[model samples]
Target: MDLIPPPAADDAAARAEVADRADAYAAAPLLNCLLREVAEPLPRADGSGDRRVYRLPGGRPLRVRGQRRPAEPEVFTAGNWQRIGHTELVKLVVEELVRHTGLSNHELPAEMIDSRDAVAALLTARARATPPEDPYLRSEQSLLTGHPHHPAPKARGGGPVAGWLPYAPEAHARFPLALLGLREDAVVEEGDTSALDTLGEAPPGYRLLPAHPWQLDLAARDLAPAFADGRLVRLGTTDFPAWPTAAIRTLYAPGRDLFLKFSLDVRITNDIRRLWRHDLLKLRRTDSAALSAFAAIDGPAAWLSDTGYRTADFAFEELAVLVRDGLRDRVLPGATPLLAAGLVEGFDGSPLDHAPDPAAWWEAYLAQVVPPALAAFADHGVVLEAHLQNTLVAVDAGGTPVQALFRDAEGVKLLPEVSRAAGWERLVYCLVVNHLTEVAAVLADRHPGLDPWPAVRRALSRHDLPEVAALLTAPTLPGKTNLLLRWTGADGADARYLPLPNPLVET
Candidate 1:
């Protein structure tokens, strides 16, 4: 019998580092939830003058101090204040939420602990891991504190660390895909899935389809029936490996110039990372809408179209695989495209890390990213989910942004299908609040006292959407209440946002 060894857990230095990293990793989302959903400001309580203190819903005063991310948590107890680690903070949050909302969630608190433990495993694995050579791949795998506002961004559906670390992108892990064949009569597909057919050869009577090996393992029990009945046959694995990008379910096969998105049952951040049937059915239409919208726009922005998909008829959503346009085909000539999320996360050799001129670089980035997203919403009625992960900025040799390419058709919303008003709101949240606000903050962080907001205001002012003028002057912007949403056990896709102080405002 063979066994898969657990992630490294013995080094003192690594253990100390994991403890530190785990605190930061786990605290961000918990803090976000606290501040966004429950915490109320109690001015000047920390005695540091500049530190902000907030009162938890349960009436405990918590003081925090840090930079560029979540601050260290210090709770008021026993007269003098004492610091609480991530685990205690989770407990504090659970207690506060129970008192605040009169709801005791058994599942969310467990997921919170799982998220923290997963971070420990990741930090341990990463301390001994080699980063990807390709800078783009490195950036795509750079999100350690993912979805800064979600309560459990790194939780692997409560699975053990060993079960997930083998495929974690943060650990710079890469592995070959598990290829399968669906019996010809049981195959269900739409659009250009020819890219998938080329991954490997199936038997004469079957069609080739590539899958993320992790997902195959997750769905193994459900798929056993088909495997036994000969409706599905194993065709071994890919000869070469595919790199898992920041979006854990999506893999980039550089050699083949292809991307394959699979059905992942784990809950990462907001939703269970599954390729749902409804999204798959409407994908071609939504992607076509985005493709046409980008084609009509005048700038260097490109849409990495989700060309097609393939799945088994018997288990459509569970066995789904989406084929998307890869970087080599869509990127501009002589330019290297980098993930925007990675830009914010910061990786080795990141163009943002060693930027020559911060303001100029930010301006160029805005030029490439802003106009097309606004235009897509206004002119073509295609509301792009232009959040950081879905957007890529390809820069020139000097690392000046020249092109912006967007992907993920499953997230794209069409015109009349969603009212123009609703589409604009979604676009504002994604493009402005979630995407640009983050990039601006990172750039500003790199260069102290350099306000990136004016440039953002300028870039947004140039857009003629009726919403633009009001957006530029709006006092409050919608901040998604991910913590409260999860605590209340609401459907992940049902986004409920509370008004946040709009950073774009000149205040």
Candidate 2:
């Protein structure tokens, strides 16, 4: 059967018509800001009328249409409009655009669409009732008392001194650098520590600098640079204080990089419970076991072994080591295509909605990268959290998914009741279907040759029957499954309670 084509291009008059529609829809001040910042008028694909497309600077493209609601002044009421200023609302507009444009969620930046500068300024003004800097920093001993209030003091290296504020003079006596990601091996002289040594050495043609002692860990290791200037720069703390609870982001380097995340709420201990379940039921039962049984497996299925769990700690260290070793031995030797394409950068470069060809990228991910990952997981009884955020795609020079890196402990799953099955399904749905499908749609929109189902089939083919059966028959696991179920319902209701058979037939 012939494939369904994208919208046909409209003429100039049609473009004007589309522009008028956008103008009408952009009547709200917040939407107007979005129009100015990210929206653009375009010709209709069907050649019937005009259309408006929204895009971020150097990011993905999206089509904007007026929401079909009866005109009501209350829709733009002051309180309602104020609510629209939140980051979540901005993300909603962005997500809608992604759906309309058929781009993957990855191509879209985290900021997606944002309000006008005026709105932002006004909001900032309103929130200025308190100082931007924490006021409690002044009382030294008082701040230390608050340490017990923190959730992960041990993770942050807090002992009996846990509650003490490292910034305070009293706390400084013991753990002066406690707030930073400084290396234990680092030597200190005249109050300055040695510069951090980056992994992979600085790539050719770029200047290198010692990373700040605080930035010496795995995430920083991936993006280490060589600086010719020989200047000592502070790489800031790799942790951020959380809201309400005193939990901290384990790998947050201000102005640098952020890694796999989990909620600070103490109630949820199984942050990566879903990943473990998926790996156990899907990968271990399928490809890993099947390949082992047949003696046809290639390379080490690290996901199936204990080594895989250890390797997860330092930013895909196992894969990075494999690649580095390959290069050292002249095996898989060459500069990574992502680096060559200028896609590899420090934390400053990460934005979800910023790919040039998001559709092409998604296609490559599903076709080439995902299948291998599924096969690897199946062999090792490893469940991977291949969510949009955890998985980093490095495009080739042509902006294709040449390299895929999955990070974040939350995204890594081990099996055997590590977490609840319901929780596991929720995580799977969020990471696999909810997140990746969004990106896949975008890819399909831009490149018709890239089909998502075919990619899924290819992944399944690489594994065995029982593993696929587990995934296909698994109940809706908790986490973000409720959100997906809302969108999947008949008029958006929970249908998981209703009877439904497994969608996939056993091999």
For residue 399, model 1's alpha carbon misses the true position, in angstroms, by: 1.4
Best by lDDT: 1
**What tens digits encode model 1's per-residue C-alpha lDDT throughout 307-367?**
8889999989889999999888689899988999899888888888667899999999999
Tens-place lDDT per residue, model 2, 148-182, is 11111112221112221221121211111112222
Residue 238's lDDT in candidate 2: 26
Q: Which ten residues in a row have the lowest lDDT in candidate 2?
A: 318-327
RMSD of 1: 1.9
State how far residue 318 of model 2 sits from its true place (Å): 28
Off by over 4 Å in 2: 1-363, 419-427, 447-451, 467-507
| Lowest summed lDDT window (length 10), candidate 1 | 1-10
